[model samples]
Target: MPASLSKGGAARLALLLFLSLIVLVFAVASATAIGDYNIALTTVFLSVTNELGLTGADIPPIEQSVVWNLRLSRALIAALAGAGLALCGAILQALLRNALAEPFVLGVSAGASTGAVCVIVLGIGAGSLSLSLGAFAGAFAAFGLVALLSNGATSGPNHTILAGVAASQLFNALTSYIVTTSGNAQQARDVMFWLLGSFGGVRWPDFQLLLVVVLFALAVCILMARSLDAFTFGDEDAASLGVPVARIRLVLFAVTALLTATIVSMVGAIGFVGLVVPHAARYVVGPMHLRLLPASALTGAIFMVVADIVSRIIATQQTVPIGVVTALVGVPFFAIILYRARPQA
Candidate 1:
């Protein structure tokens, strides 16, 4: 309602959203059929149906475990994490008025890496809560430091970027130092793999936590869509439109940080979903946040599920890291965007 859309445009938007959702569902189902075991699509469908109590299809225990526990959980995490990251990226770009802003642009990922490194390498918290707690702490710490150094959310994007860069460098250095000096070879390998990201070890519990967080974040983002529209014009313009510029900025930042931290804790700093998916959605839907957010979430979920499938298939004996796959795909897209965004000579 904020932005006027012609009937044709609205219909097109609806079609796009519909198509994106279809793609997302297909991606999830297909991804579940991928991996080393290669479960049949029929089995995947039946197993899901049986679990939901729609029908009692007799399935082998091992296949049921693989489908329900391993593949489904991994697929769900990939979907939710992708959605959350993309949502955060869209929010950050709007909040900062910067095209390049993303979920990790503010050092939250680096901080998370540092925290996870501490737990894994130093044995700092050595229990169920160790990794997640450390990651949340470090993420919030980095965000707080960035806010302080940038003189809070009112300091503009440049200052915030600089502060984030500084914090990122510091946390990244700390992670590196810990890995190089204190960690054993196994710990080092684990840390490196985690930093690069993976979904190999995810299970129902992890998926459940991520599902809740991502859904809650999405709801909050959708509620704030109108305010995000006001923000696109600039701080003064938004304030004139009755938007509380600073307060909204703070809320957006906190939500993004919390979402980023949760995902990073679950699956170690997977990159570029936040960056690439939002830009892609914006291109399709224009600058309207209301349309862009859902489109971005769906696009991101599809992208991540596909990327996860690629990661599994890229190597027979060993899985490729999700971060590596994303980076390989995202870097070229980013370059193209930058090139196109540049002024014509």
Candidate 2:
């Protein structure tokens, strides 16, 4: 443990964790309550308890279905996705030593979007695998290409970022061509909604899958906390500290790409949670990965749930895209960070 994370700092971190947990609970409850059906908090509690077989509150089937099958599932997925993306961002920043690096910086999101668009618009891979499968395959493909182009993490972060940019542009162009040439209004609308992100049809299965992936990835990251700290001082410093720089960087890149692809496959490219949440967590907990990772995950979860709730409330007849809500918030937040980072006059 670092000296900066002294007893007092530990205590403060614990307190923040406690408060964030409380807020997460409240956020989930509030999200369940808000919606077209307008479930009461008591009803939401009762419904959840009933579903868990803890109580026999005779809630109506319609209400029970809405609360359990719809709102709760979506909220859980949003939280999981947000946590996963934020974790990816934190890891990427550490791995690449670039503050601007995020899960999608490797063009994984673009690749995933292209894969999903292929499935939705062209009906490719429609029989055996689903849209998510296609998206993951595409994301991995993009990441593999970027890794190959960048010489397998041996070159430098700058080369990796450039490769990612090129791949992203290529995939984005393919996605645009597919959408424009498809000429199906319905397909185009569906693809657009997905690109912008949504949690409308999310269910327990999707939530469970994301939960497993996030928990597994998070555990791996926590175990690598010390090595990540070493990476902060540069490859030479990290290597001197016995960190396998190349191997660790490669592994972390793959992990981040997989995490990002999984989430994008489910929820579309909901940006900024990855880019901004880690920065916000660093502001609160400093740059130590041991503390930063979990803090960022919690903060991201909270942000995503709040964003989803706001999206639902912003429109009565139709829900706003989750991506739009996030971008609307993230753009200004990103600007503020950049402004603060500018050299003092």
Candidate 3:
């Protein structure tokens, strides 16, 4: 859908996407096969088929349980989370006209962290509230504050970014205060770990919820792809081209918020996937939103699934947080982006 892409370019793009999907499938299968117990790929396939009722190959109960109840769900969730975050990053970058824009830039992650800590440390909701729900509320609360500070979606990009910084600091401080003052040592430890991100506890339910959210968000973004392309030329240019800048900005921002909040609540604010994946995807797919969005999602999915696999085996008898793995990769890429984005001498 890129205006500049010719027939040859389209063929290349299609091939690239096809290959990416193949790699993603392989990465996911690898994830399901390479845990502590290390099931074979054949067993993994049969276990999956067995669960789908597509085949009735007899498998050991424990191995089947590990694949079905544990690794498969975690891998799928990682893929979805990656795809969702990358999509949000792409959306924010175009709307804000900033190459560095990412989901956490709006302070959503910080707010989710504060909300989660409140649930865990303060026993909020009198034992009725789930951590995910609390974090969701907190994330939206941060979005609300940023919206107010920046005078809603119509504010200049710089103003919105500044508001996001303020909101992040405020929520981060609140999280620290609650953890330090109210939570006991064990509670503090738990809260800290969750904030670093994990796929350890996710199951089919989390995957299902995220699949729906990510699919819906991707569909919405694809529908608005042309408007997003218009926005890259600045709001006035978009308006001149008959794009409804204000309404589109509001809708896209809300969509990003929905995605960021949902993911943070589920996985504890994994970083750099959103920041790094979109840029890499743009390089491969060019700057068109139509191609860029799905490409970014696919790249993000592969990146995260691989990251999850790396996290599992990086240390002897220990699991690194998925966030930590992403940070390790993203920080160098972040510096490269910054260096390239520096003002020309």
Candidate 4:
């Protein structure tokens, strides 16, 4: 755990993540082409090379369908969701100046969950992306509350934390009331399932939606990373260093909330990818968002992929939600982190 070795490890992890993205892209392609889950990485490599302007022959129709129609989209969507959530956690941690700060932990996820449940139970979503829209509304409302509470002379990380705690409790109460009042077992189960999160039942079209959001969110985060880095020295120091702390936070918070809402709608509120992946990345990678952003994204992508594999392998026909698996796996890992934890940017 020497400083030099930590840097080297991070560099190695970054490289591995870069390669993994390429590998995942190829794997998704092969999965689509063959219509089976047994395709190995080598086949995927050949398929991708052929697709690129590299040295390979024309891919057959089956291969094309596999790569373009089915597996590719689903896998990419999962990657995007994982990456987006991790970045969201990283940004929130910085803003709140608390390691535990995350959409789920701070009640943003709870608020979104409540809004989504209302639509599901009351049939208010009507159809379309109503669930997602409701979640976004809930997330924004929570962010607004936090913003309001953090705007005064007494505002600070602690204030935001307190406000977020209150918001979380309020949202959960509302959600419980709705589920209980409805008195339908099915509705109650749906609400509970969503709260735990998942990426079950995803398809190509859904993946397409995921792609648009992930890219947009990541682009914004990269643009904002430098300012986030400024926050390492505290808000006053960041302000002195030319950062409009409040303004930047508002923008990033909105973006993160939107990203979270979109992913929640699509994947059903997968947690810990954001909360754990960034901390994991930060352990090996430096805290600089320039490095941290991509590392967190890549790490999260790999982590979720692996988690999905675990969920799939351990299932009883019905695939376990990826979110549940992540928490079960993350609890031990996070416990270790807490035992040996220290402050870092």
How accurate locally, in lDDT, is each candidate?
Answer: 0.88, 0.90, 0.93, 0.73
- lDDT (0-100) at residue 94 of candidate 2? 88
RMSD of each: 1.5, 1.5, 1.3, 5.1
Error of 2 at 60 (Å): 1.2
| Global lDDT of model 3 | 0.93
Encode model 3's per-residue lDDT on 1-345: one tens digit a residue: 556567887788789989999999999999999988899999999999999999999999999999999999999999999999999999999988999999999999999999999899998975688999999999999999999999997888788889999999999999999998999999987897888899998999999999999999999999999999999999899999999888898888889999999999998989999999999999978899888999999999999999999999999888998889999999999999999999999
What's the candidate order when arranged by decreasing TM-score? 3, 2, 1, 4
Q: List candidate 3 stretches off by more than 4 Å.
A: 1-7
lDDT of 2: 0.90
Question: How well is each residue in 1-345 modelled by candidate 2, as lDDT tens digits?
Answer: 566478888888889989998999899999999987798999999999999999999899999999998899999899999899999999988888888888889999999999999898889978977998988988988998898889996877789899999999999999999999984999999999999999987889999889998998999898888899999899999999999989988888878887899999998989888888999999989999889999999999999999999999998778999999999988998898788879998
- The full ranking of all candidates by lDDT, starting with the best, is 3, 2, 1, 4
Tens-digit lDDT track of model 4 for 1-345: 323336777668658667867865644443333332445455555665666668565556665555545555666677778788888888888877777777665567877887888888877757765776787777767767766766732367788778778888888898889888973998788777777766555676777777788888889887878888888779999999999987887777777877887777776778667778888878876687777887788777777776666666686556676778989977877777677676665
The regions of model 1 sitting more than 4 angstroms off are: 1-8
Q: Show pairs that collide, candidate 4.
A: 32-66, 33-66
Per-candidate clashes come to: 0, 0, 0, 2
- Which residue pairs in model 1 clash with each other? none
TM-score of each: 0.96, 0.96, 0.97, 0.81
